[model samples]
Target: MGIEFPKVRVNSLINAQTRNWDVDLLQALFKPEEVQLIRGISLGDVSARDKMIWPHTQSGTYTEEICDHCKSHSEDIVHALWLCPCLNEVWEADTGWSFRNTVRWDDFQKLILHVEEVGLDLDLFAMIIWLLWHRRNQIKVGNSATSLGQIVACARQQLQDYNLVQPMKPATESANLHTAVTWSPPRAPFLKINYNGAVFQDSNSAGLGAVILDSVGGVLASLAENIPLPQTVADMEAAAVRRAIMLATDLNLSSIVLKGDSEIITRAIQAEEQSLASYGNLIEEIRLHVDSFLNFRITHVKRKRNSVTHRLARHVSDLVVWMEEVPSHILPVLLTEAG
Candidate 1:
């Protein structure tokens, strides 16, 4: 609880309407055991005034700090996670990674920003820091500290396991197979909206395309728009989705399916947990637009299946919208799919 959740009340940790624990906030603030204990307390249906209670006190009243595992006078999150003297061997060990000592930061947020600015592998940095905190908890419970080698190996193995389960990219052998398969129309009532984004480095701009098609593969509407380039390809792809949602709203279309080729963006949108990536805000906005539809789904497809949208996105010279017809450049792809 330290400085992170100072004087936080029980009511603040739960959803009032749903009457359920806020899983994300709990995970962020407490260790696994503490999270489970907090979640075990059943909430009453009757609304009552919330009062502060200290778990360590017998009468459930506020008191002085009970846990002082770290005797250091200036111990903070930055110190416990990275700057403590006990963690020196763990950080200095030959873990096939480097930790910068010259850079100075006062808090955990500033340290993370510095890591991102210096082009350090953020995933690895996060993994090591999490393991360090886990180890600190173990020590607090009188458990023997794990060796530096064991800590490094655990982090690497966890990372490797995580990557193995992620969506795989199309292999060279399957590229031709995927290209030969044409885009298929969505079933009954649902309109399929295929979107793609293109980056124009020379012009320092990006393009977005979205085409809405009905069950019989007839174009309901299509759009191509240009805007100043974003910081990354993921941002542009997210923008394409936002524009597509806006267009659907403009056309008063519901029961829609959104398809795109970016596995990263698609996965982020589909996840239950809030995204923490740089383009998280854009993803959140897209989620809000999606909630307006009666039925909404987002899907990922191979680039070849999204050829029509890809071509439209490359038409970045001007903003264009078509009704019941696509641009001339997209005709060949439509014909190919139909044939």
Candidate 2:
């Protein structure tokens, strides 16, 4: 007859001091067949608390010593998500979403707990980490590296699409209810510079558009330039910001208000925390340019309020600069906003 033992822990059958199975305990608690199976389990030399073991690997361990992409540092969750050199571009492209320097945790679970405690966008944060891991796996499988811009775009679009399909929360609904829908001119003595970026995927390039307007909504200067594709949408937006600053400097404008439709890039510029993301360098450059002005402020607006720059950004031109006048195509939007 087969013997059935009550629920017994493996630790109970092991002698703590000897770090070996207690034959007497095993025999008393389990049948001969069960004892034989228990004896097959190997014991470590040093006595320690029992841990969950992964059965798939030969070492029965899940983590690796070095990162598969960089092949240098240990492949821990933190290293894979935030510290890996190979992920620099990917993280940089996500400028405003990082909390690396401000937060610390031993493992991914604790990090997530910390993120939740701080009221950070956990969904976006998790999405980026997941995408990063997916990217790492793609590289491991010998797939070509995806562009930074594409990856960033994918992460943001996925998040946006997900949020769109979800039921609107009361707080979100309230915020959207109060959002400004029409363009407004900046207050006295501050010329508003509205900049935007547009990706020309078919051409494998991007466009930068900036339109500087006075307090009365009259266009001061506008520019549209084509450039080689950037690694991420944030990169392109950062470039657009730099171009806008350059235009302001060229005009010798000191007090200015910079506006854009990208909340991420705008917030990144305004954030007191130093960015370590790939777009960090570009953002720093923008800051340096910003310091040259006596009164400079960066703000974000909805896409609807930034139609002129959006139209200009979609321009498929090499380089076009208008001083004190905008293109004919933008006249309707400008007139509508002014009226």
Candidate 3:
């Protein structure tokens, strides 16, 4: 099976990623959709200057001249991501994977597409680039410099921590399950919703939330929403999941499962401790909807495992309301744990 990401689809992905309309941030980033756009844009889409991010680290600063900072502009995208001294620490740490010593953007692009293969969160790869730039600016602006030692420490922890990817290594989601004699994999095949909360200046805050779908056998209500300024995104995601659950209840569904990447929300919902008291109102509402479930389950997945759902959340935000009855043949795949 020759899988390919076609041109039209690729542009759509780039447009999705560059939603902010800020060209600079778009420079260092590449998406599965973008791999197709390289040649098209090269022919004639954006100007040659708009393409600075890619060319900045790719061999020559302007395709033929070396940059002043690093004498040899030989540092293309791959070198910048996996090699450059500026980001080496964050790359290995914030992320738990090592770059295989790459030299070109194509190689780096390959990594983005096959991140699931490498057991990494492909969505946050852009965040990695963004952070590297931030770390670089910190040293440049005399904010606070970083060291390789710190980077490695962070990477190992994150690697050991983020278990959203399949083939989950041993990590405890709760203390209650520690003594279980036999470990049967997760049985519930259902949809998962993930949300991120950002507390802005003063009390004004908004969240970026997404709802994703993974069905077992029955119909799944997979969706996402962008809520107005919220107290936080984590809360927003939790609230979103809660809203989805309540909707599921209203639809008269007997069984369903809820998931989010927010540990604070998941832990609070699970223990009913009200951990971060600020989300009291949202959490309380969540509690009410949660009680409506006859056979309901809620849990958390690392940001990595939440990707497909995350992508769908972003795409489906404009369109909510769905009730898709999955094909019978695929029910087994949905019910059983992902291989």
Candidate 4:
């Protein structure tokens, strides 16, 4: 109504079989809180061929069985989520929300804009919309319909969980004047690899070791390798890091955060300038390999914090790899860090 969109246009929108708009336009059109949800609907991948997906179904395709919200009525996203008689109680129960007076029932974008105009929390509104859609699918699968109060409770829990898992902070942590630096785990779904290189000056060789752990402190991988022809300690550090990246890429990890004790290597990796160190070429090589991951991070920690990797490297005067497990020698250090 606000933009003169007709019911025919509404039908075209609901039945639209293509994702034509870019994320920027969708974000501008919807409430700030709704942008992610809307982007999720659009799938955010330009190269992926656009296809119609019924938002209310688990299988992602349309099915008559998913029309449980209103089997007798002409069901669209607007009607199923906003106008269904089954969902009337959900709206009535959330007494604090002024959705009825603020939203224009004819179109979805108008509803989001109106919610923002009324100074409503779009996050909660988005959550309710998500929950309503979620509950509809749940009912379609033969689960009992969730009550309005249950829906509200679930939304709050989901919001809390989302906040806890956000990895938005800057990668560099400010060093304290006195406190010792320690290793920290990466966010969920990202594997953290603490790696170090040990130079055996007497033998003119170096050994590289890496210990990989998940967010929950579970071991995923470990590598110990001897560089028979070693350069400087910095070169060894660079080689170790590059080896870690190569392994992560081989495993097809989508996200990784690599920690190391070499300040020179870490600084070189983070900096845009080419390293002047003897192993600067190795650092550049590591950076190039990092592009293979959807997300990658390299951070520096104190040597004491990297004790486990130091011990592992000491053992690899020979080359070896342990997949899905670490050797018995690394157990004490791993246990302390896991705690």
- TM-score for every candidate vs. truth? 0.49, 0.49, 0.39, 0.46
Model 2 residue 255 CA deviation in Å = 0.5
Q: Is candidate 2 or candidate 4 better by TM-score?
A: 2
Q: Choose the strongest candidate by TM-score.
A: 2
TM-score of 4: 0.46
Task: Give the per-residue lDDT digits (tens) of candidate 4, residues 1-339.
Answer: 233323223223332344333444444456865543332221111132233333332112344433467577666666777777666666776666545645445435435645665687789879989998877788777888777668777887898899889876443433342223444667976889889876553454567889888977788898888764343445567778877777787788888998987776787788886555455555556777777788888888877788888888878557688898878978887777655
Candidate 1 per-residue C-alpha lDDT over 161-236 given as tens digits, one digit per residue, 9 for 90 to 100: 9999987667974776655687677876799999998766456577899999998888999999886665556667
- Of the two candidates 1 and 3, the one with more favorable lDDT, higher being better, is 1
Count of clashes in candidate 4:
0
Candidate 3 residues lying further than 4 Å off, grouped into runs, are: 1-219, 316-319, 325-339
Q: For model 2, how does the per-residue alpha-carbon lDDT over 179-210 read when each residue is reduced to its tens digit?
A: 54556778877999999987664565678899
Ranking by lDDT: 2, 1, 4, 3
Question: How many backbone clashes are present in model 2?
Answer: 5
Best by the lDDT measure:
2
Residue runs of model 1 more than 4 Å from their true location after superposition: 1-180
lDDT for 120 (candidate 2)? 77
Q: Count the backbone clashes (under 3 Å) in each candidate.
A: 0, 5, 9, 0
Model 2 residue 32 distance off true place after TM-score fit, in angstroms: 68
Q: Candidate 1 has which clashing residue pairs, if any?
A: none
- Weakest 10 consecutive residues of candidate 2 by summed lDDT: 51-60
Which runs in model 2 stand beyond 4 Å of their true positions? 1-180
